[model samples]
Target: SVCHANSIRAEQAETFVADRLKEIVQLPEVLPRLVAALNEEIVRQSQPLEQELVVLLERKEELKTKIEKWEAALEDSPELFPMLKDRLDELTEKRRQLHIRENEILGIFQQGEPIQVKDVQRILTSLDRFLAQSEKKQIKALYRTFIEKITFDPNHKEM
Candidate 1:
């Protein structure tokens, strides 16, 4: 019955962690601090996306300018059209790719909401309620939502 024993141990550990979390979340200062940390994490994570979007926009603009100039030159001199067409096509394709990436980043930003105190409270409340339920799937999902990693030391039987 090793599997059954292991399952029992896992349930016990989850319940212990849930109890600890519930106790910690009840404190007056914890909500604000949790919200601040979540917000900080959101900003920290978004910085690269924001920077990349900016760079993409700028590069797209530069490519637009270059493309316009090439089109104008091609129009002004039909003799050079064959030579300029390849570079113009390249700039257009690059711009198109940048636009696609910019939209993807924007989509991600649009999907995320800024974390607020009430959001944390609501989550804590859900945790409180869900922990009382007997569903392991929900409990595990809730844990995953808040816990980034869990380090278990089997030698010492510690989590």
Candidate 2:
């Protein structure tokens, strides 16, 4: 399976990737349709992660409210406040960690920008036919840059 994904089963991934590439790079004629399709796919893939993030955010808010109550109660009992202080610190750290995890989950849904000019050139070159070895290399590198990974299901014989 470590070859050009030219097989019938790979058609879906190929079409999805190619159409998404076209849409992202803004090929005007195919723009709207492909972009909408990619957006739908993105939303579908991100939904579960998004839900998890929402839950985490709600927990964070709950923790914040609890910490505020602890801080307010600190004025009433300086003797008992150390225990509450420690709990507050623990909850604050947990909330911070949760926020970081939420951001990491959200990062999965982000659109990546090419950091190099050559990557852009590679993308543009891949959109056209090229006979030269240099151009071929560029196209090959471009394909790898996207890290086209295919998953195979042995039980069902599908990808």
Candidate 3:
């Protein structure tokens, strides 16, 4: 009798769960946007590239200021001339390299496209391989556009 009662209770619980699940599934209001967000793909944009370009330009400006200060210091004290000249040369070379890199990033933006799922995954897998230096910000910004929100559905246990 105990076993029979337990079996009946189990069957009732299963039936109740089944009915509740059907009710939740039939409710269209609950699952649309969440499903859309999960299914939607991501695309690349220019904000990230522009962000890096801004940084590079700022660094180049700072380098110019540093070089100018060193030049002024050298004129004030010829005894420190050789060291200051070396530093200015290093700063000038660094600024030149930044200029070259900014141009490269601009080139990448010129060749833009609507990136898909595979492309996003590939970029995520090897961010460094996709871009270099300040362009890492670009990669991060691109990835952010993906999965911007995680909408949970308890009924389906999905995004």
TM-scores for the candidates? 0.74, 0.53, 0.41
The top-ranked prediction according to TM-score is 1
Q: Count the backbone clashes (under 3 Å) in each candidate.
A: 0, 0, 0
Collision pairs in model 3: none
- Measured by lDDT, the strongest candidate is 1
Across 1-159, the per-residue lDDT of candidate 3 in tens digits comes to 111432334334333433443443445553444344444422234667788899999998999899888888888898997767777888989999998998898787666544344544444335434433445456445445542433333355311
Residue 150 of model 2, lDDT score:
53
Instruction: Give all candidates' CA lDDT scores.
Output: 0.79, 0.65, 0.59
Which regions of candidate 1 fall more than 4 Å away from where they truly are? 1-8, 110-112, 136-148, 152-159
Model 2 score (lDDT): 0.65
Question: Ten consecutive residues with minimal summed lDDT in candidate 3?
Answer: 1-10
Candidate 1 per-residue lDDT, tens place, 1-159, comes to 111443437666676678778865788687788788878898899999999999999999999999988888888898998888789889999999999999999999998787878877887787687688748887787676767654555566544
* lDDT ranking, high to low: 1, 2, 3
Task: Write down the TM-score for model 1.
Answer: 0.74
Error of 2 at 135 (Å): 5.9
